[model samples]
Target: MGIVVIKLGGSLIQGLSNTFFEHINLLQRNGKKVIIVHGGGPLINNLLLKFSIPVEMEDGLRKTSNEVLEVVEYALNGKTNKDLVIMCNQFNLSAIGLSGCDNLLLEASLYDKGKLGWVGEVENVNTSLLELLLTNDYLPVISPIGVDKIGQKYNINADLAAKSIAKALNAEVLCYVTNTNGVLNSEGKSIEKITKDQVQALIESKTITDGMIPKVQSALDALDEVQSVAIVGENFLNEDGSMNGTVFTKGVVFSE
Candidate 1:
């Protein structure tokens, strides 16, 4: 079977929700190959503030300096990645945590250094290492950090990293475990299903503003390759066991 690349948000990882681990176990038991790409932005930010590294943000993404990137790598790969591995183990799910630089799994180029310093855009995603782990029934937990050919480290956006890995592995599902209750309307209710065209309108009207813009954009980018991209409401999951999420697909129309 192919993989299901799940991009677990930084917030989700921090909360240490048992429900998240339960869902992952279910996926594993169902014979689904799962790979987790996680972010540690909040953790990194907190640590940076503690160290007084002077962090900044623009359009929901952290504008990382070299000092900031160092803290990001340490917190993400060293701390958070290992923590997630431990959590998965407690759930009886064997996990091997890694970063993109481990085996050159994800090659990337700098993404607009003028604005976002040391942030990388994934140029290539080789999934052989991930496949091997999955084939052996081990869940591969990944930190969003890539490297160049000469071994220069770069911080890849979790959303983009997940999408790239999903597309590369031809994953059956790409799920974005997000903070909100799915995509909200002007009235602030969760919209269950949204198409590419509708997304454009939402952006234009500012209904899907802020950090949600990248979530939607990543979903749209993955739709061309993956089976489907699910913008799931993590909050809704806490309220009801059922997945209250918006499904993004290629042929989805407004009528659905």
Candidate 2:
């Protein structure tokens, strides 16, 4: 069965449409194994505010201090992960919630010499565990919180974490589920397809800005390993199996 990795943006978690879950069901019916990596930025920020802890970010990545890491873990693993699992189960998808730290699902190393304090980049992914779950027909919903060899936990950017997992699994498709339908042009229209080469140009032209930069960049990065990458919203996959989103390809126009 082909594997698909979906990266769900935290902003869209609370409002994901039924159509989104239905599309997941459709993928399963088509014999695809699905895995999900999710972010909890909004929830984390809320908890941080509730605790009066200053929320900090650098280059679109949350700057995680020791105290901030605790909140991040609680919001991501404790709340967001379970919420997504429940949503999946409600849609008749057998979803298993997990943290990147669980069973060493995602091993990591400190990023930028700990400049982003407690933030890390994925060094490895436990594909064996994933395969075992997928083999049993269970969808794994992963929270992007990683741990190092010495038991030190680190916060991982969900988009980058998904890219790492997709690369490790050599997934057939890597989809970033965002609030927007897809990458939008300056005219505010969704571009149906974008080549890897076009990504940098779009960024340069300021068409893709702010939060979308990382999502688009991560999609571009995953294109080297995954056959296809897309940035899409809830109404992404169609009944006919075609996708509606900004598809990233390696110089070839997307056909289906």
What TM-score would you give candidate 1 relative to the actual structure? 0.91
For each candidate in the order shown, give its overall lDDT on alpha carbons. 0.83, 0.90
Residue range 201-239, candidate 2, lDDT tens digits: 888888877778778888888887899888888787866
- Candidate 1 C-alpha error for residue 134, in Å: 0.9
Residue 35: error of model 1 in Å? 0.5
Write candidate 1's Cα lDDT for 1-256 as tens digits.
8578888888777676777788877778778899999887778878998998887776556777888889999999999999989988999889899899988988988988637988888989877888888999999999989999998888888888999999999898898887776788899888888888889999999888766877788889998889867888554243343456888857634673
Which candidate's TM-score is highest? 2
Query: Which number leads on lDDT?
Result: 2
Off by over 4 Å in 2: 252-256
Q: How many backbone clashes does candidate 2 have?
A: 0
